[model samples]
Target: MMMKQLLLSFSALLVFLHFTTILAQAPAKSPAQAPAAQAPVLPQAQAPALTQAQSPASSGPANVTAILEKAGKFSTLILLLKNTQVGEQINSQISNTYKGLTLFAPTDAAFSNLKSSTLNSLSDKQTLQLIQFHVLPTCISLSQFQAVSNPLHTVAGSSEQFPLNVTASSSNQVSISTGLVNATVTDNLYTDSQLAVYEVDKVLLPLQVFGPKSTAPAPTAPATPKQAPPTTITPVVTSSAMGLIRHAALSFGVAAIAAFSL
Candidate 1:
């Protein structure tokens, strides 16, 4: 009975050792791996919106009076434009038309160079025409003047009575000749796609308004007074007078003889 108990204890000890070795050889469970770190997401930048004032479309049409007013040295021209209401017309045309317009702007000095009574002499109708004479119906650039035909038509009528000629020299100088005055384009005051303003030395004088008058024939000298012819004297002989003289002599002789005899 002692040997059997000892044998049983030894077998139980061997089984316990085998189970411990199997557990040591087996793999152990690792802690769960932390998730990979991710980069922070950022919002994309956006462009700023344009305002009404800053937009190009918001700008209105060009103003002639305002342009001249800003340019200075155009006070007289500005006044005439205002008085004739032509500035408004030009502004309106610029805004409405694609054909465009060209203006020959006479400076204050240009107006001053005229006769003192020049502006005053113009009637309302004539003043309107005079202002219109300076404006071309179509826009013309400085370089384009060279290629244009002579006797260019103006906003004023283009009849023979109102002729405007533009001549450009090889030197790129432009000269404006109306029948009455020849003006040089001294400077370019302003220019754009629709409007071009040039500074002219003289106010363009249209032939219809300022042409020379026909002169009357000078008075003829009075005829000299003619002298009267002198009177002529003539001799006259009478037979009756001779007879009376003879009779008187005979009576005298008879009276003398009779007295001697007595």
Candidate 2:
């Protein structure tokens, strides 16, 4: 009995001693351990990097004047737009009515041949219809103009093709297929004497109005209407010359008759 009691006491003492030793010893940890050990998990958040934004005008010519000014080639056209109330119509009235529209402005040289009366008439609402007829919905650039070898749409909602010609002079020019005859880009010290495809006449209409629901058609053209027609007509007048001829004829007839009678 004493032996069995001694065994139980030894077993209890061994277990207690073992538990005490385990409690006394320190826990093992890596030298690099952090507060993460105390917590079950960590929360994270994302941060974005800085970046540059596109400018308001990068998309295209925002307004009529903007395209005019930026396009160096259209400087004269820009000045003309500045002078005309049509520019205001482009900025305010026409632009408001038809949003996302593009216009092709003819230079002053284009209008020089037109009778002032006719040009004035073209400025009114009804006649302005003809002007609107010349625009395109999409923003087209000089390079885009070259991509097409056929007629295209205008911001004015009309279908007009541009004319590209290779002349004997080894020169190329642009023209719009339209009723009004025009002079293609004139060559001088200007433009490095290189040929360009701008209509001698301005294709006037509203501002950048191209949109999803816009009515204007796409100008698939290389239109350059800057040439005088081959045929020209002039009125003939000989009324003043006829008077002198008549007087001389009458005197000659009378003198002949008198000589014959004698």
Candidate 3:
């Protein structure tokens, strides 16, 4: 009877183990399908857009549109912000943050110089190491820039100044600044809000272009050719060779006679 009871217990344990193994072998529901089992509900991709009231006052997406409209002089930039990707982000920041922003915006022609693949890399603005290349972090118009001597920090987040060169403001159409490339304001195209826009010769890159920041040497005034320092000369033969030599000899003889008489 004891052996029979042991056999029955073993048989039950074997059955339990077999059931557990079968359960373990079943396929798992992927993360994609797990929610379906939980709610039998609609997928997340179909979520609703933010209503006006739902948007954050400070960082709402509408701000992007406003920046584009305000900077209509930036024809090329307008199109770039309208790019399939990252355009909206750039535009939104410009709208709300324009109070103190100096955008080193590139012209469409500037971007056209780059290969399409290069532009593709800009799709992820957050990961872009080149933001400082194109943005100034301060409020500066073309006029105030003359007073700004140091390189300003750019939204691209680097200390790089656009060199200012105002040799001629004759046309009133453009202001010139000294730099690796000439920075000029948008000509004849002004928005209701006047932003000093410039079209640069080359893309202003991050501080890496200049390397690390250091104490800039005091700007020297534009150099003047200095007169060669007046040189001192030793008389090789003495005044004896010139008319002064005769005068000196006579004066010496008089001095000798006076000394003898004394």
Predicted structure with the largest lDDT when compared to the true one: 1
lDDT (10s digit) by residue, model 1, range 1-262: 9999999999999999999999999999899999999999988889576211121232787788877887789999999999999999999998788879999999999999999999899899999999999999888888789999878888878746688999887665899899779899987766777888888899999988888877899999999888787677655567777888899999999999999999
Please give the RMSD of candidate 1 to the true structure.
12.0
Name model 1 segments beyond 4 Å from true.
Answer: 1-58, 214-262
Alpha carbon deviation, residue 104, candidate 1 (Å): 0.3
- After superposing candidate 2, which stretches have Cα over 4 Å from the reference? 1-61, 66-102, 158-172, 182-262
Q: How many residue pairs clash in each candidate?
A: 0, 36, 8
| Candidate 3 structure quality by residue, lDDT tens digits, 1-262 | 9999999999999999999999999998766544434656776687475211122244333443354456454565555545533445444455566554444556556657655665454445532444335544454555455566455545444343333233324334334443544555543221212132344544444434433468779988998887988889976765557778788899999999999998
Highest TM-score: which candidate? 1
TM match of model 1 to true structure: 0.60
Clash-forming residue pairs, model 1: none
TM per candidate: 0.60, 0.33, 0.36
Q: What's the CA RMSD for each of the models?
A: 12.0, 22.9, 28.3
Question: lDDT: which is higher, 2 or 3?
Answer: 3
